[model samples]
Target: MEPVEINAGAYYLRQLRADRKLDDRPALMEAFADPRHRRYVLNYRLRTPDEATEYVTLRAAQWACDERCSWAVADLATGRLLGEVGLRDLDLDFGTAEASVWTHPAERGKGIAAAGLSAAIQFGFARLGLHEIAYRHDESNTASEVVARRAGFTRVGPEERPSPSGETLIRWVLKPS
Candidate 1:
């Protein structure tokens, strides 16, 4: 898909370009290392800096894939890495994919996730030619649910399955018009 730019209130969304180095690992680690953020997302375990670096590297590789499944959210105003919004488990033939997003703790409640998610959903539907995009979260993650809803994703259904932490999760999906 060609790169897309989406306007969301004060923020704009563009494809995460490879020209930018993923050198924000340390800051990202510190942000995710926070207990509140980690508890809800990473199950409260703070990864070591090295471990965080490895994870970011792996994620960068995923983003670099030709399929356009992942992207980093940048702050157009300050040019900082605000968060990430990504599509995974892509099924091109099926015209469907799964979506996930995260914002740095410092950036939460500033509409970063909502803007980023809106841009990603638009990209999926308009640029990727996807018919549907699914967003799943732990039922307890009210924040994520809010993002999905604000981005125009309906609560289509639910799924009960084990999370990365060995607990059950309730999943949700959204289809494009």
Candidate 2:
């Protein structure tokens, strides 16, 4: 499928193009290193720049032309990497996929994560012809729940699973119509 640039009310959503280098690693590390991001994301610690780069590079390669992958989100006005929104565990035959996202601390509360997630869900359902898209969040993350609701995702159920922090977490899923 061809990558598209989608326009939200305040931001534009585009694929994480190969030509564009990931520039938000430093900021992401800084923000994610904080407890706020770590707690919600179930992260134990922030990764180094090299680790972040490697991870994103791998994801970029996977999402470039695969059925299961995720995309990066950037600020159209400033060209800054605001966050990432992606689909994982995509079952093409079943027409379902899992979604995830993370936004830089400085970019939060401005609707960036919501806008990016809206674009990603649309891409999954419309562009990819997916029957359902599921978004999961840690139960403690009220902020994530807000984003999910704002993006039109409904809570389906809860799941207990191991996280990077080595703790079982409550998970919520949203299946969009």
Candidate 3:
């Protein structure tokens, strides 16, 4: 499938380019290594270059297979990788998917996540003919809550799930308008 690109004012949203995975690895690893950025994310440990490469490779495959629609959020002027926003667990039959966003530590509080997430939602609802898109984050992640609100998602209350730590993770979702 052809990758979709969205011009989101100061930032742009585009699929994680398979050809440029090598160049994107270092930034991704750095983002994962930062404590503040890693806390709320699942399976986000400090990664070796090889691990980052493997993860990026899988992301490319997932996108190609239409299992996920992850994109690299980048600054329009410098083309720096700002973060990522995506739809996962995409169920074409049900027209549903889970949305998520993460910003690089240096790029937080700039509305990058909100912009990228909004663009991804637009793609899911319009291009994919999605009936509903859900976004959930750990209840403790106030930052994600802010991004969800800014992206125009409405709260649908809490959900219980298992976390990487083997503890109950209480999360909440915002459904598409």
Leading candidate by lDDT: 3
Reference-based lDDT, residue 66, model 3: 82
All candidates in order of lDDT, best leading? 3, 1, 2
Q: Summarize candidate 3's per-residue lDDT along 92-161 as a digit string, tens digits.
A: 8899898978998888898899999988988898889888888777766788888888887878666656
Clashes of each: 0, 0, 0
Worst 10 residues of 2 by lDDT: 13-22
Name the best candidate (by TM-score).
3
For all predicted structures, in order, the TM-scores are 0.79, 0.80, 0.88
**Winner by lDDT between candidate 2 and candidate 1:** 1
Superposed Cα deviation of residue 74, candidate 2 (Å): 1.6
Among all windows of 10 consecutive residues in model 3, the one with the lowest summed lDDT is 167-176
lDDT of each: 0.70, 0.69, 0.79
Model 1, 57-161: lDDT tens per residue?
566566556354555687667556788787777777889988888888888888889888887888778877888888777766789888988888878655656
Model 2 residue pairs with clashes: none
User: Model 3 Cα displacement at 165 (Å)?
Assistant: 4.8
Model 1 clash pairs are: none
